[model samples]
Target: MFPLLRVFLSDLRRHPVGTLLPGVALAVGLACVVSSVLVGGAYDTAIQRNKPHTPAGSAVVIRAPGTDLPASLVTEVQQLTGVATAQPRQVTSGQVLGADGRPLNTPASIRVEPSDPRLSTTTILQGRLPRGDQEVAIDEVDAQRKHPLGSSVLIADYRTGKPVKALIVGVSAQDLGRPGGIAMVAAPAFATAHLDSTTIYGMDVVLTAGTPVDAMLPRIEATVGGNYQVETAAQARASEQPSPIGISSTLFVMFSLLAMATAVLVAGAAFRAVTASRVRRTALLRALGASRPPLVVVTVLEAVVIGVVAAGLAVGSGWFISVGMLSVLNSVGVSALLGSTGVTPAVPGLVLATVAVALGVAAAVTAALRPAIQASGVPPVAALSAVPDAPVERGAGVARLVLGAGIVLLAGLLAMLGIAARSFFPLLASAVFTMIGLFGVLGPLVVPLLVRVPGWIAGLVARFLGPAGAVIRVAAREPSRTPRRAAAVAMPLAGAFSLLAFGVVGSASLRDAVVRHSDAANTAAFDTATLLGWGLLGLSVLAAVSGVVATTAVSITERRRELALSRALGVTRTGVGLQVVAEAMLLSVVTAVTGSLIGYLYGVAIVSMLNLPTAVGPPLPLLASLAAVTVLAVLAAAGPAIRGALLTPTNALADN
Candidate 1:
């Protein structure tokens, strides 16, 4: 066992490239999954914590649509049997000026009276409550801003746009329900804020001790004459339960599954390649009197060592990424409840152990099966010459082609029907199915189509550069030999870029349309242009970064061996690395150009279909984003290319 372990370590050191690629892939996939889970969980926990808590045995009342809950309705509910107190509440949204001179729109809640004064539970951090009209208290979160103590702020009433100025008199210790509480104003001050009418959104009531909430609920409803709904504190909390967490959880699970599946395929392919490349070495060991059982143990041990190390790194990296993402979310005011964004190390450890064990068993079994069969069937003499047979003519390709065509046809029909019906779901379904069909049936057919632009560029460069350009030409000529691997690297990047393209073009178009509509509606009182420009710049940077990272990773992995060989052939290691990096940069540039063009066309078409204002102009931001992504791709590729070049010439030649 010790000897086998020794041999396994030796093998890993010799074949670091093969060992490291899958590890990197696993780490990235795990990081994405873990980050999604942590952020989602934090959001869920925060929302749950902030939900308004009703007093023990308390109930809430809200008037049905045609009007706001009348303050009279609260009096009516208070008069009911077993009802202790009914408090009317109004909630509305208005823009308030922050200290930075930016208008921040926030929700505001007003109560006819403050939460029961006798209870003295609600913490008030600053000045006394409003004593007269025009005075109001702000939440601690908002009060920290320098809205002077006596300075008045204007808020538009919900019912009407009439602006009313309320003097900031005090600040509450805590928000009404959460970190950013509903800004509270006296009812009269609220009324003065241009509210169309004196109507309540809802009412909260406390029941007499020992009064059955179930019994009192119907009576309260009857008192309000079926024109209102009643709810207890427990019920209200339940209603506010974090719905986004469930949605984010489901999405994360789906993405994790997809990513894991991709990892498995990548890992399996890498294992097979490594194993096949080492068949003669294994045969030579058997020729030197290594027994079957020892050989099997050696193979399994090698896989375990690689899997464990990879899994550990993946788990640690994932946790770090999740924390960083959480910090960003916190900064953006997305998850105020999350104090920190990190998965417990224990959870990551357990996940890593599970994934490592799974991959180890898979690699061990996959690596051992064929070698075992060959060893059993033939002596070392015959094994030396043994070669895996070429793929059989199973008509798999034909069947895939047929299935793909059918799916494409179906997708086309669905798309046509969707356009006619103007239904969103149908259009979405059509696009998804079309992608599936293109990926399955037409992927091979389309690869040549997609590669043509790159091929031409490589050819033009090769013509000028002679032998130096052969690397580019070689990659273009035999792309099909590694189509699956190429797709593995390219698809994720393409998807991310496509998403970015859609976001940029769609947002730009939408913002333009909004500005046009706002101009017609409000005569340009709102500066939609200013908002749109800032938003586009921010979103473009985000999309470019993700695209660049994905593209760079794929390019480096796919060309590692070729880059190693170039170094072995007496080419300067730096020169070879630069070539590899250059290849990636070129591909990324092409992808960006194509993606932007497609995005623009698709964006314009959708906008037109939706009857939006169409504006056709050069996409300067898109161009800038593409250039930035290309630079990022080069930077990301450089590390792997240098690693590839560092392989000793002896080892590089030995592999071939």
Candidate 2:
């Protein structure tokens, strides 16, 4: 172990950048997951904090269904045994008028602000609370949109079937747990406007010291009778808190998992290229009688170091990412709807940081293990003489082929079942299996076939060009020859595109139907989901871009000897540059196309299961983004290619 550690240290010292690049890719993914968790937690916490709080001791709620409670009920609740104070919660339904003189169309709960501050749930965020009978306090969220301070708000009174004009004297913070806005007016305002036929709607009963909430619940229920709903403060709070299994939380968790998977693919591809570059070094060690076990140990040890370094880097950057994400959410009004706007992201604790580091290390090691094993198994003589970027196998092995086929079949079955049964679990399971079967298991076999499409196009275009045409054709063929490398580069791109297409198409299909059929609460939830989908798409794009750059750069670096040999054989510097650009662009474009199609199908299947309208047209903007990413990859490849091409053939050969 000590000897292997020495070897690992030596290798790491020699190739620090190569070791760190893969780790950096892993770090991006780890950081994304960590930041997402923090953001989600912050959202939950902000929501809870923004809600109306009960007094310090145990509290009971008495809710009368359909009709407002009589004034006698509030007095009866206050006089009940163990009840210290009973505050009546008087609320009526209304709509706030927009600047255009029409109702805002969004429903709101109009609440009476009592003179006693202890009984009031309203927290003034701007100006002063409503004092005059004709003045009111609009929710901060609504004020930002239309009714600012000093603005006149017209309320559509349901009981009178007429609009009541009131001056907005103040703005109060909105409750995050509840949907829509709350409009607050003083107690006299309710009677003056005749908003509701009855005054008292419900009561908040604070129990006395040492009072058991469980014992009080039965007593309150008996006194209030069967029509009223009785609940403890804890239960009421729980109801207001966002569900753990809600759409937003679910989306965050799912995206985090996907981000980790993407990191693994990216880091693995980088490890493969880095290890390939050290073929001669490995051969020299093997020739000196170093066994395979020692070689594997040394490689794994290096991976461990890479993992730890990546984890540290990722953990450090997580907080900034969380803050930025929260800011974006607030700007888009998602935070305003779900919780408080401008709320700080919850700080991740020591335990969370430790877990993030562990995940980073695990992701890095998982990515490197396969490549390390393959690198160590190379025979000394072959490693000494072989090209650095030579293919390990021409095609997928029989075992892999069988396994991939079985998995694909399982995916098809799951997808069909999901559609037939209208089940989300089966559909989600199918999506997972689809990526695993097509990309993870059968990538080598599939990528080569996909490569041929671009190769054929390059071949035809080469005839139209002069010397550069030959380079283009040769570059296109390079990915096909080394199927594993091509597959690794393609995997992240395909997965990202799939998700992109899903988000784009799914949102389009569901938007109109959801707005038409669902109430404001349901519509708000749907909108939030759409916004969260965009966030996921951003993460996927980051992973995709990183994967492309890392793989393309490594591919060019690995072929230093090949490029030098071509230069020796009289290929111009211009030709070599074109070759580099062609390689990156072709691989990126093909994978992007493949991924989009897969993702579109997945979207359609899910939409069909939900019985929603299926969007027909493809997402053009997302497709354009594929081209944009290809250009970015080409730019990355061009730098290394031009730099290497500047070297004299003799110098390049010597360096290789």
Candidate 3:
């Protein structure tokens, strides 16, 4: 056990990047999950904060700006058994002015309330809360930003588009910061201007403690019947979490799961490669009297260690990631309809950190499972034999290829029929087949072919690498000879990259379908689609790219002897590192490109089948996705590449 502990520490110290690469990849994915949740929290908080608050005791705030209820409806609803207080107001938009009289619309809110703190959440900071028909109170943020206390404001009636003037007498604050301005005014002033009985905005209902909203909702609706809506505070937060885009929260959980799956696949591939490459070492360790199960446990432990480290980094990174995502959403101008809530990273709790770690461990375990089995299953003599003791069966390989092709053909047939008839279900079936069948079937065959690309690239790089080029170029070509191992490693990379491509294309297709197929307005459909696409895009890239790096590192790890020999023969460490990096990157690009093509065709087919106008040409996002994956792949490869380059000849060559 002491020897085992020493070896574990020694391996980590010696191969920091290789040992940590999977963890880093998992970290990126976990970071995305954490940041997304945080961003959503920030957005939800902002919605609750930035919007007009219900009076302090209010349990539910319902607004019907479109179908304004008569003021009489609130009087009846207030008489309900569970109701403590009901406040009614008229809602309208106002173009507020600064002391300098310009269009100041940054801060936004609904409901111009009266000067009572018990009914609303406004904190007066300057002068007094507005009490008269000619006065109003502006948000303190906007007051400081431009329209200060005592500034003249112009209110535009939404129905008639008429402007009315009023003075901002006081400054007020909302618990959550609003990006747009919130203003308050005397209730009489709002009523005097908009006297139409149908123009009553809505009512805020506050239930007594222990009175459930659902219970109170029916009674209130019974009082102020027809066209009225009831919503609890929890519902309000959920509805406003991501404005305009009505994607299900379940989908977000699914996206996070998808990211974890990607991490697991990548980690698994990398671990498998590592295990296969270490067969000789494992054999020696067993010969030295170590039991097979302990060695396997130790091997699995490496992945667990990686998971722990990855989770820690991911927790810290999540905040920045969330902030950046929200900023980007805001920049595109579809973050929300009326307001673009500025997001802060959600405050992380112990639960959030624990979830991240658990996810990491899950991924590590998934990755370690196959490799651990492989390492323990083999006899030490068999393990010490040449890399693979037996020849690959050509008949089995051919049979697999045929089965995969058959499935692909069936998928194509399904897609064509679906497109011809304008049916989405069959098209969906086709996508399932295309993704599962193509990757499952063709990945191995293509991997050997793709492996040659890096070998050719090594020739070009050899010029730059000088002495190291020959060594790398030779090593790069070696994968072509071992089709079985190459294919095994390549399948995960292929599947991961393909999924990345599919997610991007599918999001766009779904958006187009929603716009054309549903009654949702074009603006709304597009906004929803755009947000959804971007959200899924992050998950796809992080998961796939990380998987590629992990797989490549594992594969290249087998070359430790070659790397050590190259170093002893006078190749520079930088050159060796560059070779390893190039190999991983080239492999990723080739597979990603292949996957992208399949994904694009599937996206087009899906959109067409949904009876929507098929988007023409490739979108910039698809291209951007490719570039992003490539860059991430490079980053993931860095550690393993450097470790490989740093291998010493004496230690590596003496392994046999």
Candidate 4:
């Protein structure tokens, strides 16, 4: 055991480059999964924790028919049996103008109540409840600026076309984080402002402890006569299942799984490549009478070591990243529903389980299987011989073209239909198909083209860097020699990047379209800026990961003997590695720039098709996007280049 452990560590140290690449990939994938789950779960938990504060048991919220329950519903529900007390509350959202005339509207919550003990549950942070119709209780967070305690605030009722000057009588901590602009005032004041009490957004029910909510629910429904939606605290909380958040969570999980699966494939391919490259070493061990069992065990041990280290690093990094992201989200008012941006790390069980199931077993099995079998079966002589180039399948070329054409057609059809229908799902579906088709059809042709750009750049650098640059050219020039293998490495990266780019562009366009339509329909009703920000953020994350994967794969490919030879001839490893990194960075930069341009055009086209106004100018987000892609390109290159530098001449030249 000790001998094997020592051998494992020694091997990792010796071939740090090879061992580290996969570990890094694994770590990245693991971090994404862990961070997503932790943040998502925390949001879920926060929503649950906050639901109980809506109202006491048996107290129901009431509103006008087909409208959000009005504050008056609290009174109607209080009249029911087994109900302790009902507080009539009217919630309205609108811009509050400061003295400077700037709009102070940011998803505020307003609750109008008749100052009574029945509504005393509303906790006041400072000052007393409103004594008159002209006074209102403001959320503490909302009162921070020019609207301090006892300050005059202008509440603009867009529906009424008037701004009401109201005195700030009290500030409540409980009201601080309510979604939309929340202000507590006397019900008459809300009525005076023409905020209709007939329409209730939601009703909270406070029932007696011994009373069964189920029996009272139907009766309460009967009392409201379908004019309002009534639910007990338990029912309301249950009903507020965070459907949108749930969908996002599911998407995050699915993407994480896909990333993990990609990591597994990458790990497996890397293992095979390493094993094939190390045939001589395996043959030498066999010549020394190393048994098949011991050989297999050693291979398995290597994978386990790599997997454990990667998982450990990933888990820690992921947790920190998630915490930090949550903090940012909170600070930026993105997740204002969440009072605190703090993320409670999910159960260690979830983290460990993800590592074990997705990364651990998959990596170990992938790394060990091929090596174990080949090491056990291949004769010592064949093992020592150079790897024979496998013949290319002629059919694959035709297949690539055919598949590519089919995918393009399918995506085009979907996009057309989506544009015609003005449906986002169709557009999203089109984007997915387009990405798949693009990689399938254009991978062979496009990757070679993409590879050449880097090759040329590397050659130019070779003028200054010399040998290392030459090695980059050599490896890149014959990309077709291992076209399938090269594509295997490049396709995943391309797919990921294409999807990310397309998704970002598509989502932005969709949001803009939705905003325009909403503005036309009812400008005062909805705001799409928040949605747009979230969509862009998600796409940025996707693009970053894709860039990382692509650059890493290219770096690994550049470290072969051909590369070593270049290094041997006085070219520094850093220079050679730099050439490879440069190529990848260049490809990504081109893709990002091209994709953004195309996406913007596509968005305009869709808007035109919808018969909506295409008068909007170029999106402001594109500049930020370009910056993000540039940063990602630089960061992604670091890992692979470091690996390329560590490749030893003897090891790289041995097989050649």
Clashes of 3: 8
Greater-lDDT candidate between 2 and 4: 2
Report clash pairs, candidate 2.
none
Model 2 Cα lDDT, one tens digit per residue, 299-392 = 7767777878877777778779989988888887787666356767667778878887788778877888888888887677865574554444
Residue 442 of candidate 1: its Cα lDDT?
57
Candidate 4: how many backbone clashes?
A: 34
Cα lDDT tens digits, model 4, 1-656, are: 45545765786788676655555556666666766666666766654443324443324544454545544456766777788765444555556676766675443456655565344435566787775657877755456534678988776665764677778888754343345544444344555554543334545556667887678778888877764555556554466456645633565567666666555545654565556555566666666666677777777777777777777776777778677756765555445434323435564466365654456646656745774676555455654556432222122377678878888898899888987787767776776676566544565565556567656887777778576666566546544443444444444444444444444455555556766556442222223334434442443344244434543554455446666776788768768667656655555565555445445545555555655555434444555555665566667766766776777877877745
Candidate 1 residue lDDT tens string, 316-365: 66567666655655454333222222222224546545755575446434
What TM-score number comes out for model 2? 0.85
All candidates' TM-scores?
A: 0.68, 0.85, 0.74, 0.69
RMSD in order of candidates: 7.4, 4.0, 6.6, 6.6
TM-score for candidate 4, please give it. Answer: 0.69
Best by lDDT: 2
Clashing pairs in 3: 55-119, 55-120, 106-180, 107-180, 107-181, 108-180, 108-181, 268-367
CA-lDDT, candidates in order: 0.53, 0.74, 0.64, 0.57
lDDT of 2 at 227: 86
